[model samples]
Target: MSTCRTGTGPLTAAELEDWYAVPLGRADGTWVRAGLVTSLDGRAAGPDGLSGSLNRGSAGDHAVFDHLRRWADVVVVGAGTVRDEGYGPLPAVPLVVVSRSGDVPARLRRAAESGTRDGPAVVVLDGHGEDVDPGRVLTEVASRGWRRVLLEGGPQLLGTWLEADAVDELCATVRPVLVGGDGPLLVPRSTSLRAPVGSTTHLLAWEGDVLVRTRLR
Candidate 1:
């Protein structure tokens, strides 16, 4: 992780390992966390309409992002994010999908079906009729023996899961830009937590992004 040059340079592999090792905090049974990036203006993405755009010039954010992904057992995400970001196959971990119309994104669906080097592992939870049950989705992930679940979201999905109390922790990256728009917030304003939440606890800052690690109260 030496190339992460910016805020902290030449970081040791042992340091990153120790930092992200217990990132999700203490886990009673299952460890679930959402990893998303936001700008200073609180927009989750820029005009490009993708969070990946947040780390366009800086590879530092990407290095940390990839590190977190590598530590995850499975990635949980919403269908909208899959469509918007054009999700592909995850290397080793399976994807636990949450879709409304049971529509898996074309790119991911094809990768799972074709069975290429992209790796074939995609599980779209039946999110038809009503909203997808967050507990049920977590249960499915747990059933697969996935202890560390990394949730990548598109606001709405995060809000729902947060409301459901299925989320164990949140890892958000605050970028240095002020992407102004009606762009998505870290959590959609339309959805609220079951109760009022407070400020997020600061974990660490790397490069130009601020990392916040907190559990729902």
Candidate 2:
């Protein structure tokens, strides 16, 4: 990985991979990963749902996001985030939603259908692993044979996965800006874990006052 000064600049695909990709060696059947962009002050959201405050990077960050989305077999997000972000399905990848409650919002259903021709698949994670019908949801997503799941979250969902110890790797972008408000942070506090979580820094590029990628240790 090469080091560039922190400011606005362009980043290449190679630079993106060097920073974001953290090999887990393929033993963990469920590869739960997160991609987040945050300001220097640690704000994850602006007044609106968009992370525009942190999108100061050159075209490189956009390319990186595209690559990450394409690489994953399935994209997983919380119900709240899906509604807030107005996400659509990817061309080749399937979409999965992890909801404790079986309830899915109306807008999400519409967005999912609009993104895919067949339809979008929903996965509800019942706390008891019972009562809810997993088979029905799996039928849609499983048909595509998606083994790797990419988790894109808005703090709360990411914190849930971390508390469950289900996350295998983390790919985070730390930007150099401070927007302190009643907004969300990159990662929420984990009540389940007693010790501090650690990560190894893999500096990809320095562009537009942002540091592209770092791996969870």
Candidate 3:
């Protein structure tokens, strides 16, 4: 296991590659693991919606994010995150919104539309069977030819996937900052993998942050 610890301000490209490259292999054709950066105190969010505090990575992290987006046919995010972060669609990848309810904020719709030409296609995951249709949502997303999907999430979404055993890998970038707040942890609760679980650590050269990559064994 390779581990890097950073006491400096943020992360660099080398650090990002060291963190993200191996987890990229964990995702088979069907699923990809969710990746996130969290404070040592286990806060995924700051007071505000922006993760800028956690975004202190070198150019490499940005490049890694871009690569992940490119490799993923569909990028999945919870609706709340889309509203809070004001997320937009990637150039070529399709954006899949997992909303139990059909209430999608107009800004996301507009952003997805303007960014992706035909607007973003919304997929509401009706786990509750409320007013939405899960069948139609799955069908529409499948129609776009997105076989492999990546879920970039807030805690709740991550928890849901973990409970369902739908996650294939989990890549986490643990920064050295200790922002002790009752914010949120990377994983909501304890989860057991289906069978084998393997992990590797990469020590970043510049930043002392460690990237831990875990896959289903």
Candidate 4:
């Protein structure tokens, strides 16, 4: 996870702000970027059923996570992740829980209610029977001008989006550990991690971990 290469390397304070001040021009809908981590052997979760072990207190990775959160207008996640990760309220952004039933965790609901104007908005993909139509979700979000969307996901949800050709980009960090469970599957759209629909570009290497971005359809 050393300095392999970088399109935007040496992510300094100035670089972090405005994504190295690269002006990613606007388009028709929301720009969806996923933030995920995996082990060197490719497992999203460990024996504990969470990504914490893969991270193992990697401050650089955590900083990247925070930066993604700050960069997004809304944070979208799957319900299973909310339960397994035991999430609470976010700082100043709303959370969108993509589910067939559109049911939210009680804690998350309470957090949404007790917080500032930011809250949770439900988008039920009942038409697809638990298969979230990410396009519809992004369309809804984009209509509201929440164009910077971050999908912090459970693999299944990301897999669904990936299959639907909905993701705009994927930002990932590959840690040095190798876990045995399911091998950090980024998007299970296919049987294996295929070449990204577009291409994968290295962002930077941080704290013995590799950060990369993949442009998607």
Candidate 5:
């Protein structure tokens, strides 16, 4: 995968890594980062109701996505995203999925059962309703020494975290394509919500796609 380039010039792979490197955890404290890709019109997913379609021609988005995963100690995702994306176990980093039913996906379970080299292990954090407590989820991963948290969300999960002001950073990829649909936005709609204020940390582009990293203090 190629590194992201600014409008002025291209960046090397190491430079890109430095821009997206995981921040060090302090004394069991976690740095929560949410990674999301959306279309030009702010649709989190395309017409198919999946984020993958929105990533069709965004190689730079994919590059950042992979880098975020690799740099994280563990990947935290909602159960619906796991099912919708047909997620398989990761090769290295452990995956912590939030599922209400406490049921592990068959594919993930199969990898665990066979003890294959398919990916790292999966831990299902059972929640009560449509989502789980963001703090609880973070605590679970932090307990396991996985403090560099990467949230690959499906709206509700991300929204909850954003509402709670638990997200420390946000890495958003905006593709040039416009997806007009009832798809969810980066943050769930809330009229009375106090959105977190963030500072732009890095902005990079590649193949007409834009990657923005924001730091929320």
Candidate 6:
């Protein structure tokens, strides 16, 4: 990824990977990191109401998205986002779909049922009639030894995690565009956490996309 930070040249691929890696000594608890793409006006989706649309032509954002996925030991996403984004199975990386109804995307359902080895096992984590608890999800993730967690979200899912204080880091890519109509924000308006949650750790730019890393604790 190219960095536009002053006094620095483009970052090498290894350097970029290091920037996204889990801290060296973080073995005690799960490190939950969220990845989201937003527009210049703070809208999480484009006019199309899908996050992928926000990064439509931005290679940098796409690169960072892939990097985050590769860095994750397990990927957690809400069922709605998975459906809205037309998500498929990832090769060798477990995908945990959190759903209130215990429903998952069709492709994942097929993959899970077929006992397919071509992709990572698709797991449906039901909330058992309650709001899917972020803590519960993380506990299960830790149980599986997948501590380097990545949360790809729909806004409601992200807001819930933020309210529960289950998120450790947030990796946001701000595209240089605007979608002025009503669109989702980074978090839900009803989220109880009134204050901003984290400290800015890194601000790097690549191909007009600004990547921000915020440490939540």
Across residues 6-43, which tens digit of lDDT does each residue of candidate 5 receive? 44214567876777765564456678889999888888
Tell me how many residue pairs clash in candidate 1.
0
Q: State model 4's lDDT.
A: 0.69
**lDDT (CA) per prediction:** 0.74, 0.59, 0.58, 0.69, 0.78, 0.80
Lowest summed lDDT window (length 10), candidate 6: 1-10
TM-score of each: 0.85, 0.72, 0.70, 0.80, 0.86, 0.89
| TM-score result, candidate 6 | 0.89
Ranking of all candidate structures by their TM-score, best first: 6, 5, 1, 4, 2, 3
Clashing pairs in 5: none
Off by more than 4 A, model 2? 1-9, 14-24, 28-30, 56-58, 107-144
Off by over 4 Å in 3: 1-28, 110-143, 189-198, 201-206
lDDT of 6 at 38: 90
Model 1 C-alpha lDDT per residue in residues 1-217, reported as the tens digit of each score: 1112123433466666665556434454577778888888888887888988876765545766777788888998888888888887777778877888878877666655565536437877756856798878877877878888899897888889888877777777778889897888888887866576534543566666676666653
> Which has the better TM-score: candidate 1, or candidate 6?
6
Model 3: per-residue Cα lDDT over 1-217, one tens digit each: 5344433324454644444554333233355557676667776765454555575653434444565676676777877677777775555767777676645676555555455344335443534534223234435656776656677777767766665566667756566677665666666655444554444433333355655556633
lDDT of 3 at 100: 66
lDDT of 1: 0.74
Ranking by lDDT: 6, 5, 1, 4, 2, 3
Error of 3 at 174 (Å): 1.6
Please write out the lDDT profile of model 4 over residues 1-217, one tens digit for every residue.
Answer: 1222374334666566645222363565457888898877767876687877667777767877888887788888887787778765665676777776656677665555555333444332333355667877877787767888889988888887777776778888888787775544755636333453756544677767877776765
Best candidate, TM-score-wise?
Answer: 6
TM-score, candidate 1, is 0.85
Regarding TM-score, does 2 or 5 come out ahead? 5
For this target, which candidate reaches the highest lDDT against the unseen true structure? 6
